[model samples]
Target: MKFSACLAALFGAVFVFLPAAAAPVDAGHARVELISERDAALPGETVYAALKMDLDDGWHVYWLNAGDAGLPPQVIAQPSSDIKAGAIGDIVWPLPHLLPVVEGEIMDYGYNHQVVFPFPITIPEDAMGPVTLDVVADYLICEDTCVPEQARVKLKLETDQAEANIREGELIGKWIAKSHVPFPGEARVLKKDLNWSLSLRLDGGFGKVRSIRFFPFGHDILHPAAQPVELGRHGATVSLSAADMTDVSKPLDGVVVIEQEDGARTGYEISAVEGPPLPDTSGLGPVGGVGIQVAAWKLILLAILGGLILNLMPCVLPVLSMKAFGMVSAVSSGHAGEVRRHGIWYTAGVLVSFGVLAAIIVALRAATGPITLGFQLQNAPVVAILALVMFAVGLWLMGMFELGTSLQNLGSGLADRDGDAGAFFTGVLAAVVGSPCVGPFLGAALGAVMGHSAPVVFTFFLAMGFGLALPFLVLSFVPNLYKLLPRPGKWMDTLKQFFAFPMFLTAAWLAKVLGDLAGSGAVAWTAAGAVAIAFAAWLWQREARLPRILAAVTLALTLFGVTERAMAPAPAIGASSAYAAKYEAEPWSASQVQSLIAEGRPIFIDFTASWCATCQVNKATTLKSKAVHDFFAANDVAFLVADFTRKDPAIAAELARHQRAGVPMYLWYPAGSDEPQVLPEILNQGLVTSLPVNP
Candidate 1:
């Protein structure tokens, strides 16, 4: 018996000396282990433990606050019946690295290669010795794509006062030491306009710092935007753009990371006050890392190109048709000086209109929220006025009445030779009506600088307006192109009459737009006002003082009545898409998108508005086709429409993120990927079908 007792004691001592560890559970992309620092712990003692994840190369897992996408690693823990529940405190999250999930597109905060999460196991003071804990860890592992994985492991701790090994305890200490320390000095966060800056005043100076970055503990931070870092003596500020952060009333929580010249980095955790005088950031030159500055020149060029494309839009096409006739007439009239002068006047008109529009948009955005392109047309009054102008122009072209002055020349067959005012007004109308067609190239450009300075906004807008007038301005200057026009003859009358139909068509289209904007009541009122206008026109042709006076009164009454009725605000409603019903597309919602993505389903989002002619054309063709529908059905792709027909700040913010001015943004979120793929503004069935659903 004595010999057996001695043998049992020896075996117990040997087992206690061995490190307590759970077997590593394979999780496809990673291996997870629940390990303890020592084999045992006495009553009132705390044993160090960690959940270790050994990730495959190039793969990563998210931190508590994932920057743009993915969720943090979570442990599935049940109450330990054997151990006190309060003994286990909240999980400690170590500082994670900021990863560029997609370079220059998406960024996230996460851990890569290997990460250790410390879990301090406290032994209850009341006679407890051995404790068993179950840990089932779930995490999203990502590289080019994301995969949700899980690993389950059981860790056992024996109770003993004397343990031979303390190596695992020392190792856990090192991992815990790697966590971001609390900021030693004052911290502040300031939100100026749409831009946000988080400043840190550290105890240690910034002299040896190589680069600095702020990893915000929230996803509202615009990850892809340029974060210009400004560093001072012991201070640094990271400037960034944020969306949907209506309340900056709470203190900002984030980790501030700084790299050294030796490639090593340190992180400091902090809570920042909302209001601030701001720390000094003028001590040193710009640091080299992370965000790349957006190019203003590139945006201006893109805006010009996009504006040039607007000439092809239906709303602007009829106006261009009239200008084509004007150019031909100017050439036939043989006025070289006047031709060049008209071109200059027309360009001046376009630039002036664009400037006014830019100023209005800037003001509205400052007062309200995110905005760009076609917002003017949201006012039913504007649509009604445009309709009235088109109808009046159609009547004039049909030989209703002709005026001899500069004002009349503005409507004559030849804009350039008729009068400079005519050419200028023509340019103004072209720009005003063309504002709705925010096509590609311009989307990204405007998006890059939308929340910027007033001067910058005007510059890009003027460049775009210049592009819109480029075609006609060139014809006005180039004598050779003028020669391409047929000589003025009796056919000019017939051609002029034919052009009236297109003007009428534009008028009808504007009426339809008004109906959509303010309901059918606006359309009925506009139609009634049109009849009054036509009667007034006929009365004016009678050439009597009383008749002219009556005509003027009727016209004024019609205009006043239309303006009053059209300006009435419409009831709020969801954006309806004709194509959505036909294609079985769902209305877009951020929560739905996240849910579908988590389910590993492919999603295709169409950012469209009814006022957008290009968006309607695409829907009438590519998105409406049976082939596109079949592809979606076959691949289990969820079709969603982000309708921008009405004012929606959420949609505006989303569009701004993609650098788009307005609707017709096609976003393809493939299965197993969080980052969406931006398809061209114009989509084809073949391209839609060819998108890969897997990595």
Candidate 2:
């Protein structure tokens, strides 16, 4: 149902092309020109033409459907008798930006710098002289105020020296791609009082919409009031306000720009007939109990706090400790410059890792419908690889072979190269290790950004990454904190060696998670792989060349065997759910939850994953405690487990509905309530049992 909003053929493969310019009319804040892709056309050939407007900085002009105020650029195209052309069709307008006129508090949509309004002109089959086309353009230019502008330009459709202008053709093609894509589904507008709701079926894969805004093609129908969107299952509803009841009665027509988390945007041209609004699958709005709406800034702050707390998580602590020590070593060495450099590079590494996570989100949203944090840990192969990686780090820490300083091992063998490379990779290692643990303040923050724009999600994650790196970064610049510690000696080496045991423990834990995903065979394979890694490292350090070659082969074989040997997860074991053995947690599904709700049973949903360290902690303590279990049994509360150990589209969608990117989301629904109360990311014993049974 992807439809092109333009009347002309605008779809083409991307290419690099130079631009061709013609003499233009200077209209104060705007420069206007009438140009064609072809310098001239044959009697039977069709040519594309456009009115190009280049505005001065901070200055702007209206789109074909200028909303609220201002006028669309008008092109009065009068072609010679030889040339066949329809009145300039819906001006192929590039998606516009929201500009608020402060003087009148009016919101106007238009172009800031440059825009191309394209139209197709076909030449007749009959013989004729050079086709002369005279064009008159009228537009409004506004900055702090407004100005009426006009331009008169002439072009010849046919000439002896006629040729295709590659530059102009490229320019036209570029703008066409930016123009509105037609609303592929039904568009309807329903009104209540002075407010109008425009419902559109926005397909998935738009990629974390930052904003879904509508700009009406007509005046009065859409006022300057804020247009807030409520994203739903298969579509979204935009709350629009007109100036009055009369204006609200008018049909809504214009472009809807769906801007994703990443700065990419898609503008859909929708024409809505007055009718019932589309079914609000999200159930958000006044009826759905304060919906999944939170201030973006609050989400961002929560992300930062969550990141800061991640360093203390068990999964990340071992690598982080080593990184901290390295920073201290640099400070104690009195190399202040090196310390700061290391900090910056380490932060960069963290930010870059988060960027990869962003890319994964884009991919997941396109393939599956919803995605959450720790998505990387869901793949059994990824878990196996992580286990191997942790084992290798353990071996390095135990001094099985020497690459560089003990500090370098923290970066997983990358830091040994004299530059701050070790510090950088150490940060990377910390992030990867930390991925399986969701810490305090992260769940709601990450969840809030799940269905939002890419830029927002990226910023939220970047803030979290910065928070994770902040402590080490601060220590690098502050030497006094390390001054209290004794100078580096044998004790430092002993401490480094002690940290290796944590890496080993972590490796063991990962193996267990891997076992949960695959079977005992997978665990056995990983253990054997671990042994092979240690042996290979030991052999590589030998002076003999044969031993080094043998070590390489052994390492290669181990990786292949470990990855390929794991069997498909056992279905009866419920590999996709969590904590079933510890407690009688039923597998969660939307339909089941609704059925339970209908039966008047209170519901508690534990959104968790096998690999998430935080999820495991809560499962062991708060969630499994007898007191909490007894409370639920007495209250007849249904305990549902939505395990995210592996990606499930239904689970993903549910997570998105709750505004979460990953697991450890604890939701509580009262017996008679439909909306589930989102618990803190970190669960506590008293917290779970304290809830009222009949409330």
Candidate 3:
């Protein structure tokens, strides 16, 4: 039914175009007119030829590059014997919009107005007195269906001396400038398997660059309809993946036209230079390049290692220790059979928890479609919520009223009777607690899963779960290990309470994380929630019914408070570029840098960040060193720090053109080279000393 309706709409549009073709050429409906300058002067003197079309309300014409399916208006000028025409410039296109014609196809064209096409003519010196120039033009005019239209225009004038009209000259010049395409600035290129990354820097107005389109000029280099990855920011970074990057070594030059959202189009020829080699990713995958086979093996291995490491994490450690203590107590009581049963139950619990997590991940991935690395981490709300949740969990561990199995006791006393179920839940709780600590080994594994197909991702996750469960599983079966544990006594109670401190510490860390995610208000709310929970726990232990009611009420209120804060619009944390002066090429120009150096301006080019791990490492190590500090003080280089912590569009654009998308992009304009010399990603004191100085 949808297809039928679409076809009907298409036919209806085609019918509307028929009447426009036969419409008479007149002032009110459709008209063809000519505007020109005819004069006999020196060869270098300029002459103008213009053809204007006054179309009816719904009629339209095509631009220079009609795009997909339209014909451009062609002009043939009949010049006098002495007059000669230079290279015919491209037609100045008014703004164009993507018009959806058929269901699947779209045409980029313009509509509904009087449009003109102008060409320049040069007159030779010692020309005749009278000059008559004739023009023959052909245009394909369309409304829905199209019809070809032709017209002959002529103009005659006499010129013996020079004459100039300021208005006419300005009007012609304005149109000519509009017709000329703009030049593209610096660009950096990175090669991927299927695409060559071209990062461009747009100059001029912030909002002026609306959409960018790349025309390869060569065939089969890029696939048709290969969408550019849109990084929406003032200084946006776009990724263009070519069909193959093997052919490109250095910069690949091509025409790039940017169309403003407000309907202005500017064209430029862009060259994308080769960027720095990709960073070391040895442990990320195989020793060689990232291929399907290597990535799969790496995922499996990392998952197992990560799972094994989880047992040692603060969150999971307490739970595992409790299980060990439980077994020791059972064995000391001469309940060997009970110890064995508890071990089996605990293993079951861990496996079941893993199963549930796998199911959730699989289900979510299926429902949402392919779980790409970018997609999984893209949602800001989700990230915020996860951070908040982790923080809350951390606080709970820090000695807040014990959660988890406390509620299980209320349902039916069945929870109290079921040791197996308790063990299972403990396993589940371990997994939940371990989530925040992604750990070194797990990061690469998880990243690979995010980038790969579903089967590979699932396999890796399963392997990781197996590794995590292995230690607990082995302990459960090994009766010797259970016997080896210290006998239960008064000391067991002391040890149990001692283990709680780690939970409390974990909670404090989580609270700080919450502060980072939601700000000071969230941290304050967390403190209040902790207090309320503690009071509720005390009441529950004293008067069971009273505690239950209070616990319910407090939980409700706390959740409401947390939810309100979480849902609130995120407050801006960083400065915006809108207030700063547009980075003109004045201060950083070669001459300016040289002059500033001569004047003894202390220049400290800081390549800093808010989230770069390497930058943080550098800041803590070399950059903060006293020697480096004293050197800066002694030399008096002007300190200028560029902080690229958040989503800074200008910084991103600048980085993109330089073939960098990550932080720690440093440049020291020590007064020459026309361009700033980019610093290496890693920094050292020696490198700083080597920088050019005007001694």
Candidate 4:
């Protein structure tokens, strides 16, 4: 990719030089004429060339940098022998208007009428008679898209004892001063765990300081859009995150351009002097490395164990209590044998639920391929739906309705009319609810499984399912355990009512997750849904058909609101671009890559994600390394970052091309290569430097 970018740049540069039709002089606008005051100036005396621009209404041109994207006029002079040319200063720029572009923020400079660029000529100390000089001016004129304009203006100068007026010189001096950007003092780099801190002293008082923008010469060394945390007093101490810090050892070199609130601009070319290496505080105490690793492992293990432990979770506890109540009712009704049958049915329900989940996961895995390559089940819509489902279940559990009938009917048709199918579904629901809370050992096991082959992944999930279902399975097989339970009584009703709190809590959690996925509107919808559910349950219990209809209508409205909220546009990820116009991103293809390489342009490829934690982590870390940046700058590698963070079909196709289903994938194409070289999950400075480039 780097090589391809370099080639693209080369091609662009070459294309810039190709002969083309000269932009016609706008006869409607002001015209400029170049003439020397004297044929030649005497040695040590100044000679002058007059540049006059014709103008139309509301026309102007500008100085270099053009504030943003418009180019400044260039004057190249060719002098004959017996003549010496002094410094050729920049042309004066009138105040320019800001032009907005489609893609990024860029300012352009040009005049509708005409402008003049004057330069002084110094004669040599040696005697000189007549001198001839030819000059050419290349400039860019723009109304919307810029057009390069060039013209040749020839003149002859003879030795003259008298000097030209110095008023033009004074004007040029003033413009030069205005164009100059003041330098700020140097700064020191302070190293932290995952960020770099810079403490710099400004020459002027803090009162003069307004907004500061740091432009790192190396593109990938830092996130360009990350807002710097500024601590200002006598001096400013800025902390920059290194989540995208690529090379730690590499020095930071950049320009800190500070724009005052008053519109005054000053700049500092800062080289971040390295601070002392951070202390290896790894073994400080129980709270250090050992603890962190243990905690991480504990979380992973807990996830695995939680799957097994979920059978005992509060959600399942209520169902079990209800089942016990039913069993007691049966017993008193002279159906004691039904207890054994019910237990077996519940066990079957649990296993079948596990098997169903396993099958779904397996099917998804097969459909999507490797998880490591970018498989994410929780896309925006999916997450919203999952949250909604959980919230609905929570409402049901909270006695929003007599969910018993619906719950029983859900899996009651399996095998016999046994209530065991409900138990199985409960098991499945438990596992689903357990997903967000990754318990100990489960994280490591899950991480491992995600990168594993299909069989291994399936086996791991199977083990997790078994673990989750184990408790229910064991209890179902143990009739002695049922015998130990207290006799069914009024206490069971109180317990059933008490179990509603857990369901309410679960509902609250699910609502919160929904809010995160779909925004505050989702939260509002869920809250409304909860109220409706409660009312619906009350109406159902009252056996009032009219109230039940109203409750159903309310529930329908709430669901509709949730669905609408889920479909709303999300906020964009980063700061918008700063360009005169934004270009539509062309699909990356081998041919395009080859073309870019041939052009000698640099490319930046971003492999990103909306759900991937690691992809974001890399963007914050190694991809932003200083060494990687320096390599790119030195090679002029076009920086193209492929963003796979969202559901971009182009990115998906690219991933498919690379045999990947997910992101954190990288590919570098050197100049002339039809294919791109794959990069590793863990980016390194060496890997960046090792990228092939064409001269």
Candidate 5:
């Protein structure tokens, strides 16, 4: 279906070449030109030509299919006897911005800047002389007032001297790329009171559309001024007002202009079936007593808040504390400049990491279907690697080995080369460690990104990183805060060593996650890798050049060997598994969920993963509590666990269906309700126990 939609958009969009140009002629408030795509065309060749217009500020011209009350620009090609003009194809229209003419009366779709319309001309083999073409163009330019415009441009083409204008060719190419075609999914039109409502179901990928607008190509059908587009995650609906009730069953065709979250504009040509509107299956749309749609700006703010709260999460606290102490040490050392520089570097690191992470997620989602949040954690090799990394950090903090002389002086505020590097990596570490524990504000913000454009998603992630770094940034600039920290002493060393325990605990937790993914053998491999890492670090620190080289080789071999070993196959789903033993809920499947729904039983779906610290915490507390279990039992709610410890396309789709990128998602479906209520990231017994149950 997606491939067919792409082909429909690409049909008749072939590129042709031609040559010729005329000086821009001033017509009303716009400048018009007849430009050719090539220098000259040989006999029996098709020539591509374009009508270019540069409109004055605030003034616009109509599209080929002018809606409601505007005239479309017209082009008449009269070639001399030697050259015959073929039937011009559809004018390649650039996506038009919405133009409101009268208050609540008329909307015009057109262009205000540079606009290009492409056409093709054919020359016969029997042509005798140089081809001479005479073109007459007519258009209406309008701002507050409208003006009739006309231009006649003549072009002489010489076969011997083929015109090649690189700049003009590039400009035309850019305009062509910017032009949009029809969406590659499904769209339908339903008859409403004096109007038709367009409902569209777009394919899974097109990363987060910021907004969309529709331009009706037919006259006396859709009311330009009154149509409004309502956007959802996977679909959009627009009300098209009609001129009269005459045969509304014909397929509705028009161009859809979409502005993505990143400010990119594209268009699609759609031919929608005229029928009764289909039922809304996409959960993104509104449902009574269910999820509420959050505004974009609000989502951004929530992302920031989520990032701010992440500093306090158990997964991130240890690394954050170390960074904070380092910042304080710099402040107490009277190196104000160093403190600010370190803060800036740290912020850059965080923002860059977030940008990269968002890019990877968006790109993957576009290429493959939906993917879970922290997708790396779902891989056995990744979990094993992360465990080793955490263990190494723990060793470093415990003084098993020093990074460098400069980095060891953490109290001096990484002012030197090694120290600066440390600060930047620390920022990166914060992002990595903090990911497993979804904060209260982060869940919705991250979820929103899954449903929106790439740029919008990037901005959300950036906002989060900024929020996470904001506290340290303030402390670096504010000298008063430095007084709160005790002076650099043995206690500083003791505190650093004490923090290593948390790192070790985190490493152990990741090892458990690895075990759950690739079986118990992967845990053994991870432990063995940790031992090799310690031995290598010890040898490198104590020995000379040759020994250090050997140590480096040994370390590399150990890492690769362990990752490979940990990636070995695990037991099947039904086999005895650690995850199965740990959780009491029934395994979730699409069929089971649908069956429960059909049976009129309320459902509680826990979308979770073994690696997610937040998921484990919630499972141990709110979910397992007797009160919540009793409430579910009494209400006849089927408890299903959608475990995302490994990659599952169906589970990924389910998460995407709910606009979630990652898990620890708690969904409550009241009996007889089609929509499920999305719960907060953090949960308590009361929150779960109090859910409304329909009898």
Candidate 6:
């Protein structure tokens, strides 16, 4: 019996003393191992452990939220006998790089080459001997194809005699340090109609933040695309498009990554409170809020003042002659009440026109991204309609048709009733023609309104409309102002005839706007339409049935044909000689600007349009001056002209970036400074020459 027992004990001793095999047995595309920071640990102490993975070339593992596609790696740790681990802390992940998946279809955030995920292990006081732990790791490695991989890694940590492995501990320490720190501020999510606005209230703003990007922690919260981040002095707000699958009740967690112009990056983890009440978006609060209500009020005041100044611009001046004629005729006819009524009707016309314009802008902005003032004129069809209207108005003033008279007296006399209707239509005409002019102080106010909420934008427009009507409104109400006008006589006829020339000139200018939009083909059609309308007017003046019938038919056919051609897609600038000479500029692109900035070149960006009277004036008077041209050439400035004559979202965004509602926006970027110095709306030779030249 003793010999048999000795034989059993000898076999057991042999098996117990044999060396155990160390695991992390390699998988196909990745090598994952369970590693302990310390060789040993004392009882009742915490130890750090990591599941380290090294992937083969061209293979990557997903982040916690795999964005559009893929799955994240998983780790499950099991303790051996007599080894107790409290709970494994959450895995600490390093910052992930963005990976384009599916080539232009989807994007995924992930890591390649290597990743170390550190987890905590707890040892109970009663623990004895070596501590053994097993980690089961499952991960998907992806390149052209994805491969599901699993590895069982075992780690033995001696607890009886604690010993530290400095190298391994430092590696774990490095990974732990790479984890994202929590954002130091109050962050809340505010719902704005169909989208979400994330507001981060930092104490002192994001200093020198060139760009900010956000990554959500899960699906069904944010769109898997980038959003525009509007920065303020105190913080930043990012416009986030919500996914249809988002659960509004749940909180949002994400990372706010900021990159400097010099390419340095910093990241912070943020937890945003969901379901907050919508905040006030009126006035200037939407323009970077910053808790300053006064600033918004100031912007509104500026908008009103800007509108008052707009009437002085050359674009609106010609229309005022019609208003003056209506007032003089009413006073001479001994209808004093009609003057005030005309003013009221005209004011109403201006206000209603502005309201409709604002509503259209708001709707378009919601559907598309940023668009600018005079955006409607960018459409060739719209320009064509406006041109026809201008031509008809000119012809009417030239005695082609009589107002309020019988059709039989078509070309003989003016309207017999009060000119209130004419005054109202004139106001509407003024607003339409005045849209392309961005006068002094108007650019800043409108730019701020454009970047703000819908309510604020509309309010600013109303205020400006009021300012525009103020001058005429006062003139009608005050008898002293009207008495100064010359009495109605033969001179009135001469003056009226002379005014027709200006109307014709204005129509000719709109023809240029149409030409820029649709090329020479559209211009030719416009010229034909003009000829047809003039001939039809002459035929109508004959007071014969056959001529009038033929006139109506000719007018209808001309408009229908012109409308069809005007609505077609504009010919490419390179393919159109008229457009080539009209602009004479290189196409402006966002990427090209960035590339030039990267090369540290001084840049001069001129945001202009063919229809904008202010833009044309600045170009002819200041930009084309010999002194300004010479200075630009000597300074090695890259003269880039962004023609807003056509609708371009990129140019609109650039204008918004510089706080300009419309053109004649002149920007000067000195070498070594990314921030541009905006020149005045009305430029002079001194303004161009005074700019500092880079050595």
Among all candidates shown, the one with the greatest TM-score: 6
Better of 1 and 2 by lDDT: 1
Which regions in candidate 1 have their CA more than 4 angstroms from the true location?
A: 1-292, 365-369, 405-418, 451-453, 575-579
Root-mean-square deviation of Cα positions for candidate 2 versus the true structure, in angstroms: 20.3
User: If scored against the real structure, what TM-score would every candidate get?
Assistant: 0.62, 0.58, 0.45, 0.37, 0.58, 0.66
lDDT, model 4, position 579: 11
Off by over 4 Å in 3: 1-295, 310-422, 575-695
Decide which is better by lDDT, 1 or 3: 1
Name the 10 consecutive residues with the lowest summed lDDT in model 4.
280-289
lDDT of 1 by residue, 84-168 (tens): 4467655677877878765445678889988988877676677556667676788889989999998877777677574535777
The lDDT for every candidate, in the order shown, is 0.74, 0.72, 0.51, 0.49, 0.71, 0.73
Identify the superior model by lDDT, candidate 3 or candidate 6.
6
Model with the higher lDDT, candidate 2 or 3: 2
- Which of the numbered candidates is closest to the native, going by highest lDDT? 1
Per-residue lDDT over 386-426 for candidate 3, one digit per residue giving the tens place of the 0 to 100 score = 34443333344344445435656567655434555556655
Candidate 5, which segments miss by more than 4 Å at Cα? 1-295, 406-415, 574-581
Model 5 Cα shift for residue 398 (angstroms)? 1.2
Superior by TM-score: candidate 3 or candidate 4: 3
Candidate 5 lDDT, tens digit per residue, 295-362? 66877888888889988777787788778766755665667788887788788778888878888876
Count of steric clashes across candidates, in order = 1, 12, 18, 92, 13, 0
Q: How do the residues 1-695 of candidate 2 rate in per-residue lDDT, one tens digit apiece? A: 23664423343322112223348888788788877888766766666788888899988888766666788888776554234336335567788888766312456778888888887776655646566667778888888888998887666655543578777888998988998887777778766544566677655523456777887766645444545555655677666655643655457778888887677888888888887656532323211213246767887777778888998897888788778667656765666787788888888888888878777765544333345677777676778888888888777777787666434546766452444776778888888878658787776566566545657667877888888888877766776754555676777778777778888888888888887777788888888898899899989888787997999999999988888876455434543355654569788755567667667789998888778888888988888889998899889989988877765545655665566667788899889676788888888889999876566
For candidate 1, report its TM-score. 0.62
Q: Which residue pairs show collisions in model 6? A: none
